[model samples]
Target: MSLPPITSIHNPKIQRVRALLGRRSEREEQSAYVVEGVRLLEEAAAAHLHPQLLLYTPDLAPRAQQLVHTFQKAGVECLPLAPALFASVAGTESPQGLLAVLPLPASQLPSQPNFVVIADNLRDPGNLGTLLRTSAAAGAQALLLSPGCADAFSPKVVRSAMGAHFRLPMWAAAWDEIAAWIHQHSLSVFLADANLGQPYWQVNLRPPLALVIGSEAEGPGPQSAALATGYLSIPMPGGVESLNAAVAAGILLFEVARQRAAA
Candidate 1:
């Protein structure tokens, strides 16, 4: 039998989850983050990343209850929370009746990574999340976030990423660290820009490369530019100035995939 449900919103575990959901620092401090609903946890399980703790409501559906039982069987602490208390802590307007605290995935770049995505000062959670999703789909070996970028494990990002966090190797690094990694790997760094440099489709993306995507507002940072072996541009004949960061990333990343496939 499972332990009794927690009734207080101020319960220590509940408070911790709230802090993790609300603040990046709290997550960094604990080396953990919260994921809402059943889907994320399912992805986490698929990635072999298990949650440390799970909180759910008494009225949870049977399918979701089964999910809770799976975690319970795995030795994860499963706690029940009163509906009102769960509502108080849930990040979504309509609580999914399931929340889990999962450790931050400690993923490292594979040896001889031929493809990586570098996000330069991207602050929008949705954009960053989409980039993570696209990178995983496009077969990038890792993702590097530059300074001033939004926290990769932030709740909004985790939700928007649709479980990419469970699978992608992502790290937030200083520019110097990013540069050193590029050199160590001998990767050809290509910064994506709206204007300047060779058109992206024309470039031979089959080589071992790191693609740098910049913030939509300020473009690439000086440090980012300093690290670039070259720049890439997507041709916009419609006379548009630029594209959404995620859209640009999707287009560029798929192009990389296409080139490698045809090669």
Candidate 2:
């Protein structure tokens, strides 16, 4: 099939990409997102997530051209746009002139998973994404998202995740549903908080565990607060209030990985 030419800035597809970059509602309505730059598109393709449509500048990055050809042979809609038009739709100040509207993964978390990371409404994209990267590194089975967290698919979150969005099973749930799953799995729910309970290293994380991190500003929501079996803290010997949420989560997740490895 001949690839369709996107010659005009007013093209509906171009308009859609612009809207997706600017507004969350457009992404929600279309079940699409603006994944820009060569890195993201390359990783998405490596994960076998063929995009519904691959849009790039007429001049493609040399490293990305092979992947573009692969998509074309796979029958995905792959083509280029005007450099000026592509730049207007790209998110970053320095545009890579490459992007795609890939479908979201269909994998859901197991009803009672043995190992998991529960994000209890993390508000910061960078924090949430770092948690995801940490979880993947620590060999956690999946990432379970509770209410009030940033959209897992948002461009900021995706960029911060550093390829984790394609690597792990990520799912969303209500607090009650997550709570019920915790109880059903006999999983120990550990909440990481700045001021509370035992130091994180003292906690036994080898068993089926759902390690929960909370919002950056307010910490965990009331539902998560009430549901925590116990709270764990990391000592700040330097008189700091606390580490950033992602830093804290990375420390705690590695702790869990350490305990399991030792056991």
Q: Indicate the TM-score of model 2.
A: 0.93
Instruction: Give the Cα error of residue 148 in candidate 1, in Å.
Output: 0.7
Model 1: residues with Cα > 4 Å off, grouped in runs: none
lDDT by residue (1-263, candidate 2, tens digit) is 55555678888888877888777777778877768778877788788887888887767768878777878888988778878877777878888878888766776777657789899878888888888888998888899899888888888887888888888898888888878878888888888889987998888887888888887678877887777788899999999987888898889989988898899
> Best candidate, TM-score-wise?
1
lDDT: worst 10-residue window of model 2: 1-10
Model 1's TM-score against the true structure:
0.97
Highest lDDT against the true fold, candidate: 1
lDDT at position 196, candidate 2: 88
Off by over 4 Å in 2: 1-5
Candidate 2 displacement at residue 219 in angstroms: 1.4
TM-scores for candidates 1 onward, in order: 0.97, 0.93
Q: Write down the RMSD of all candidates, one decimal each.
A: 1.1, 1.9
